[model samples]
Target: MELALVLPIFAIVLFALVEFTLLFYARADVVEASRIGARLATMPGITQQNVEAEVKKILPPQLGQGAVIKTEMGKHSGDVVMVAVSIPMTLASPNLLWPVGYNLKGQNLYSETRMIKE
Candidate 1:
């Protein structure tokens, strides 16, 4: 009887742990992608489209599918180039749990980086 009572709770906790771990990993990937994009943006003769492509390549397929990338070019020395990436993340369905009314759907993660022109 006790096993039945605690089983659902244990399952939900396990699901939450895994989901949160994946979420944090995804966030880190986004941060790294933005930094790389910004660094590439700082180089001479690198176009905005190239920066966007590099950022997309760094991200996983899921995140890259709906990623929004913004790049700003720096024309003069010491000017700052900016790269911003926005990725909308979809959490596991509440149905996967015991239906405790938790809605983590449609969470968006954003990262921005700026670097001076060389």
Candidate 2:
């Protein structure tokens, strides 16, 4: 009886662990994309479109076009250029923990990177 009772709980925990692992991995990718975008933004004469393209390229394939990328350039040469990226996370599989209200879908993961203009 104990085996039957604990098996489902273990299975749910395993699924939840896998789901969170994928989400964290995706989050790391988003952070790297923002850093790359910020690096690109630091260069002079780079338009918003160019930065966005590079950022989208850096982002994981799962993100698709739902990502929002914003770039801001300061007036002076030595000023900061910031790149902000936001992506909505979708778990790899069905949320097994949803029965307990542990849904993690559709949550926006945001990353901002700032670099000084060259």
Candidate 3:
């Protein structure tokens, strides 16, 4: 097996692994942010803007940037507050021999947390 032929494949695999890890981190951050936001919602006289700020503070820098943060206050009969965070995944390069694509639109990280308001 020629090292030249195998090196590119190895590189692609490594890139894919790194990309997946980043996505995982983003997802965790979003979930944590949602949970934090929901907790804030349970506070008395807590404004939506304050909750939004808390969510942004809890999220990672990459997840916070260009990310959509949504909140549903008393959307359910139980007065459960719902928070959702989403962000699109972008690839570093597209020339690799893998499924990596620049601006992969469908790739999104999201989280939902529900809590009763106090």
TM-score winner: 2
Error in Å for residue 44 of model 3 = 1.5
What's the true lDDT of residue 93 in model 3?
A: 21
| Local distance difference test values of all predictions, in order | 0.84, 0.83, 0.72
lDDT of 1 at 30: 93
Task: Report the Cα RMSD per candidate.
Answer: 2.4, 1.7, 3.4
Model 1 per-residue lDDT tens digits across residues 1-118: 9999999889889988776777789899899999999999999889999999999999988789888998889998789999999887672122243376655566678899999998
Q: 2 or 3: which has the higher lDDT?
A: 2
- lDDT per residue as tens, model 3, 23-108: 67767777888898888887777778898888888876656776688887773345878788777665222223336454445667
Off by over 4 Å in 2: 91-94
| Alpha carbon deviation, residue 113, candidate 1 (Å) | 0.8
16 Cα displacement, candidate 3 (Å): 1.0
TM-scores for every predicted model? 0.87, 0.89, 0.80
